[model samples]
Target: MNRNIKFDNLRGFSMILIVMGHFIGTTHFTQTYFDFAYTLIYLFDLPLLIFISGYFSKDNPESSIKAFRTIFIPYLIFNTFWIIFIYLTKGYVPADMYLVPGFGLWYLLSLYLWRAFLPTATKIKHIFVISFILAMLIGTVNIDPNFLSISRTLCYFPIFLFGFYFKNLEEKFTIKRSYALLILIPLLIGATLLYLPFNSTILILKYAYASLHMGNLKGMVLRLLFILISMIIIILLNNIMPSKKTFLTKIGKNSMSVYILQFYFVFTIPDIMNYLGFNYVFNSTFLCIFYVIIATALVCFILSRDKVNKIMDILIIRVTKILMKKTTP
Candidate 1:
């Protein structure tokens, strides 16, 4: 299978947005801007990440084992770390507001689940079509929010299947400029409607059963539309600013490490700046941007180091190997 450097770079960029969205979410920003930023992030962030993940799938036992080690193991390790970190910081563990309840590690957990189901999902013709319809139907009914696992799984599983299907139909659709505009225009329209007063009724109905604010018919339409737009923009950007070397590609390769560690900067730096009485200046939107950029660069630099990453990878491998052996025997 041919690796698309373009898609890989786009995936890295999407991760940056995920980090930025989280940062903004934690900060005190204007409600309108915050909502807009969040809508944009939700529109395509995880879907694109999942789609890119599916793009790397191969039908081999070695790749499957690597997936278990690289994806599933890190997911479990990080969830445990998050639990411990929260427990130590606070007297008690709170509900997982980061992604979903009890599963603050939703990103990793969902990806692991989706990947595990890929073998079965791929065999079905029109898997995405079926999943998408079900997602919309479930979104419309207003299910109980307490069943968060079921709600999120229903909402996201379709997109996961969409990505898997996209990988299967890679050559069927051309990434054309016209298709890009077609997707972008509808996305903008849908997003605009979401902020309108008329959308309140639909929004209320949608949120009744799911913590997901964007599960309604209108919202899902916009979400998928934005995913299409994101793909188009990524393709266009890739064509315009084509990388001649493998530098960005290498960075893209290690995006997972960048992702898991980014939270340290997102959550910690703002508090630290406030403590130092630098919050007055550093709390500005511009400063937030600067801090995030610098912090991301610093993180990328640290993770890109051969010695540090090698040690981290070795530890992860050893831990996963032990876990696997214990589970198997």
Candidate 2:
């Protein structure tokens, strides 16, 4: 209610994590490092995002409507553009256009679906939670792609609901010492799970496989524990390091534009470097990291500038406003 410093900070943090996860994912790395980082990304990246999304849901129908315009419209527009880009560049749209490497707009598609259903979802929280857990159970056991979709939908719904519920709770529940403890407990649990070894023979390649192999009881427990850890870290960070009313907040506010546009840099910048002969200049691991760091910072800084982002902000708002008016009664 009080502008939710925690939620805002968490949103910004999650966006950065998602971006970094993609960067790590796309770069050529040793198997051990990739596997570890990929596993962590799998465990918390999306759940944190969905939780932040839910946190902002609150009780406002208008906000939900705006979220639809902001998330869904851009998702469709960007997806279309990417489809065309792929066709022109590669002569065909890639089969996994939805899974745009380093962009992760597929999450946007999934988020859009959840936002559209939030109205009905908010009304039946327990039913949604139960249904989601059951679906995850079924998906894990059967190993069906359709079931995987259902499992993800179900898993993230509770996060959205938790966000909605927390928005309300902020009014009634003050941040106390106990609240901090509640956050820490789950983090510790998650840390233990990550460190502890399980039977290598039983481990699965896919995330769903790992969950299924863990068995319903352990899988649900681990997943719930991880979600709790993520939520707690978000809350704790918000309480400790609230966003200052500064440039980062402005960037965070316009994060979607930054998000949508960053893909061009992520996908094409390597090629651009190759063309410019920077790739040959920096071929080693240290140089590669330095190059990525410089490139990413340059992209973020350029996009963070007022002139470019202001124009984008104006265009997006005008377009979204028109769509909102048309969609609304």
Candidate 3:
């Protein structure tokens, strides 16, 4: 029906999938199964997040400025904190890496860029098709991934554009939700049968095709396929999902917190689980799957709490506000 709950549910669920993806990759499980499971989750998780974000995107200067204050500032803070954290904990000198994004924080920068540029981008004719072409062709270049997050910015921009366009598309056309499932079911089955070689890094989208040792033409084809599939999955799931307030609703509402804090869990949770006898107990693939889900749910629950969100808002958003106010000219 007419409710935000559906979007929140999707966001919450996708966010959990994001965390579970991290868990399954790192936690000891049958290597074969984990790879497949990770591949399956990643096929659409980040796309879903991007789509949902674009669904709410505004084409205005005010919102763009706000994105800088809210998102870019936090991104900078996150990078700085990580630099310090790594040096202190691992004795790694991340020299002159200030402009680079750290791990999950790239999404923050991407979002800021989208807010800033997508408004102007929307003015271009056939921007959607152009975005797809750019997303595919950009991988053939020799640009570094972290240099202003350039590669990923181009790679994922199509999905972001689709998200922004979908809102208007739906308003004008009556979409048949049933048809989406008809296609999605067979689409998933065939994809699963293919069992493409996937890892967390590929989904992160920071590497060039050359970096991954993939032929440029072949990599472009694969990128196109993945983008198409992700678009389908994002559309179908949003249409089919129940629009009701539930466990995931709260998490969705606070999904940003879960996203930002998840790296902490991703890196440490496996070790903690191992020390607490997780790896010793969950031997089978299914059992490890169960454990990872439970662990991710618990972490999501904790991070979704109001207190945690407020503290993060203070650390990220509030701090940004303070900085912005001081620098306002």
Candidate 4:
């Protein structure tokens, strides 16, 4: 089947943002930075990716099997690999890495949870509203993020629902690109300027107000604002996003490939650079930004290649077949 250029492009766009965020964070040296760009990206990148996940979603009970095949199986394989890799490299692995998930692995587990429950979830009327309430409510309890990625899963659920509902929008939604840009650009600027380092945890939705040293009332209010603003950002992005073909189209089409493959590089690049006596980039924001851009371009270029995607596709298919054969009558 032919892929949607726009969808792939958006995935590419989101995937790059994910890379940019992680690259900036994990490499953090004297670049021990928390500024507007980082803050702003954290606010929407994962949620946007989750929304994209739902755009392709269907209300099918059988999708749970698909989720098990694709999302769950890959997550288990990678999670185990990540654990072993960390054990060898870092000297100790987390006891709950598989159940709790690491930073990059959360989305895969969360997506599996979302996909597995989707059919039953869709049957509930007003599920979007319920999901939003759940997102807000989940923030009240300080659930350790390492525990199943449950906090993020609930927090991002409504945005995913919005994307699902958006799939059926038959001209009910229309906006001028000029207008969307007018709204989005200012909002982006406002969000950037308004962001602070301490506020970063709220963006991830992984902790309670107490855990963040915020009052419950204020946290709830801000959380509500974050969710609404993110929706607006996504809607504006949809209206303004270009449909024309570009390199990002291929990157976006094979976005999951870029996503999983980049994990191999995100933490290593900075360390490799630092060990080579190239610490200058970490000292200056400009150099750091430039470094990440070059790194991001390289990752997108190499990881999104057809051959790499084919290999991953083949691996997932074979693994799924094996799992099915072992379990089925």
* lDDT tens digits by residue: candidate 1, 1-329: 75567766766666666666666655665555445655556555665676677666653445456667777787767766677666875666656533343333566656666666677676788887776665556656655543434545555665565555566565665555566567666765575445443332232222432344454556667445544454554334334434343455655666766667667666777778789987764457777556656765666656545566566678788888788864453
The count of residue-pair clashes in candidate 3 stands at: 0
Cα misplacement distance, residue 202 of candidate 2 (Å): 14
* Candidate numbers sorted by TM-score from highest down: 4, 3, 1, 2
Q: Estimate each model's TM-score.
A: 0.74, 0.73, 0.89, 0.94
**Which pairs of residues have clashing backbones in candidate 2?**
54-163, 55-163
Residue by residue across 26-139, what tens digits does model 2's lDDT show? 565444544454455445556666777776664446656766777777776677777887787669876655544213465566677677777766677575467456534643
| Model 3 lDDT per residue over 1-329, tens place | 55589889999989988999877867746567676777788888899998888888898767777788878888888788878767876789676566677777888888999888877887889988998888888888877788878878878888988888888786543346797678778887666445455444656666888887889987788778888888878877876777878888989999888998888778776677678876664667667777788889889999999898888887875677677766456
Q: Which portions of model 2 miss their true places by more than 4 Å?
A: 1-6, 31-45, 58-68, 94-103, 131-135, 141-151, 171-207, 210-219, 274-283, 313-329
lDDT winner: 4
Candidates' lDDT values, in order? 0.59, 0.58, 0.80, 0.82
Q: Pick the candidate with the highest TM-score.
A: 4
Which candidate, 2 or 3, has the higher TM-score? 3
- How many residue pairs clash per model? 1, 2, 0, 1
Quote model 1's TM-score: 0.74
Ranking by lDDT: 4, 3, 1, 2
